[model samples]
Target: MTLRWSTLDTDAVPAWAELTNLLAKVDRTEEYYDAEDLAEELSEPGFDPELDSVAVWDGDTLVAYSQLRVSLALTYEGTARAMIGGGVHPDWRGQGIATRMFDEMEPRGRELATERHPGEPFELRASGGLEDDPARPLLSERGYEIVRYFTAMQRPLPGDPLPEVTDPRVGPVTPELAEPLRLAHNDAFASHWGSAPQEPEQWANGMEARSLRIATSRAAVADGEVLSYVITGQWVDRELYISIVGTRPSARGQGLARQVLTASLAAAAATGEYDLVELDVDSVSPTGAGRLYESVGFTPVRTTATFAKADGAS
Candidate 1:
């Protein structure tokens, strides 16, 4: 079979979404995106489709694709992170399509990282589905090590007893609180592994995503300062995804995170538009976030692993 290779553009959205949803079902990743969602991603801040993405097709059928992105901000360790993402169609899996895609992505990731953060150390990172994901062996063979695991947890909406948000400080997120919440998010995730502050543009992209449900999102504030927040969005039908949940360091032990999260959950439940609320948390969260979610009735449904390879200058 003769294969055609080209960089991605707006026209690739339909094929990309088709292959992605297929992979989701075959891999049990539960990640599904529509053409609009894929288009939005292709337009993310700092991502140049022509330079950062690639697609492979056999005649008229798209068989595989890959994307590379380097963070705009450096992690707390002062290291840049380049993330690789994409998949090969299930029917085309064993034909070395994935390896070929990675061969092009890895060096480009390094180049992008060096250009973005000159002279700094960087890590090439990729995440895969469950324990036995096909990509795991390829990642391992390439010297990537399993560095972290994240658990996807969920609770049925309107049925699970949610904690009451009695604090006067907690309320639904508002347009006026956007900037404050962004600042709070950066501060809250400062020490989390592989996390970096989201510059204004990146933060805005997320806040403006079509799926973001401001009415169901909640935040806590005091004296005009945002202390904690829970941002919710929907990708899958009848499911509310908790996109971000954080509390600034100064407010850690006050249970503010729980307050805002529960507030968001309660708001979503009240909507009666969702059947479940879902979120993924670091398995070994520094703030004991896993326990907090569990206390709120979220049960683990699956886990994904992150693999990393150190690269670039020391």
Candidate 2:
């Protein structure tokens, strides 16, 4: 079979989305995206698709792809991380297509991380849904070790009694409070595993995501400072994805995170546009975020594992 390998470009958005959604179904990942959603991602800050993305095509059909992105700042361990993401079409699997994509992605990821972080230690990270995911053996064979697990949780909307937020400071996120929310997020996640601060451009990119539902997203503010936030977005019809939930360190224990999250859920249910709300949390979160989510009626749907290979590792 003759195959064409090329860097990703704007013209490939539709084909890319088709392949991605197909893979999601085949892998039971439940993640779905429209071409427009992916187009926005291609334009994300610090991501240069021409250099950091790869697509494999047979005739006019996209069979596989890979994307690499380096963090803008070092993690708590002082290590730079390059997140590698992509998959091969189900029918095209087991043909070494994924390996070929990784051959290009892994080295490019290391180079990009080195360029961005100078002499800082670096690792390449990737994740797959469930313990039996097809990619797990491939990653393990490539010297990648499982480093973390995250659980996807979902709560049905408009059904259960939502938590109450008595603080009048909690309300829907506003355009004017975007920057403050970003600051709060960075501060809140500073100590989390493998997390790095999102620079202004990255933060703005997330805030501007096509699916972001600012009307249903909630934030808590005091003295003009954002103390906690719950940012929600939608990729599938009738399903609200809770993309971010955080409370700044200085404001933790004030129950601000729970307040904003519950308020966001209440607003979503009030809209009558959603059937469920979903979010992913670290399975062993240091902040007990999983318990908080469970308390709010979320139950685990599935768990995904992250695998990483340090630079220069055999």
Model 2 CA deviation exceeding 4 Å by range? none
| Model 1 residue 230 distance off true place after TM-score fit, in angstroms | 0.2
Residue lDDT tens for model 2, 1-314: 78899978889999999998998888888899999999898888889999999999998999999998888888878999999999988888899988988888888888888888999898999986688889999999999999999999999988789867888989989999989988898898988999888888889888888999999999999998999999999999999999988988899898888889989999999899999999999988889999999998999999999999987375
How far is 97's C-alpha from truth in model 2 (Å)?
A: 1.0
lDDT of 1: 0.89
Model 1, span 28-119: residue lDDT tens: 99998878988898889999888888899987788899999889989978999999999898888889888888888888888888888999
Those runs of model 1 whose alpha carbons end farther than 4 Å from true positions after fitting are 312-314
Deviation in angstroms for 131 in model 1? 1.0
* Among all candidates shown, the one with the greatest lDDT: 2
Stretch of 10 with least lDDT, candidate 1? 305-314
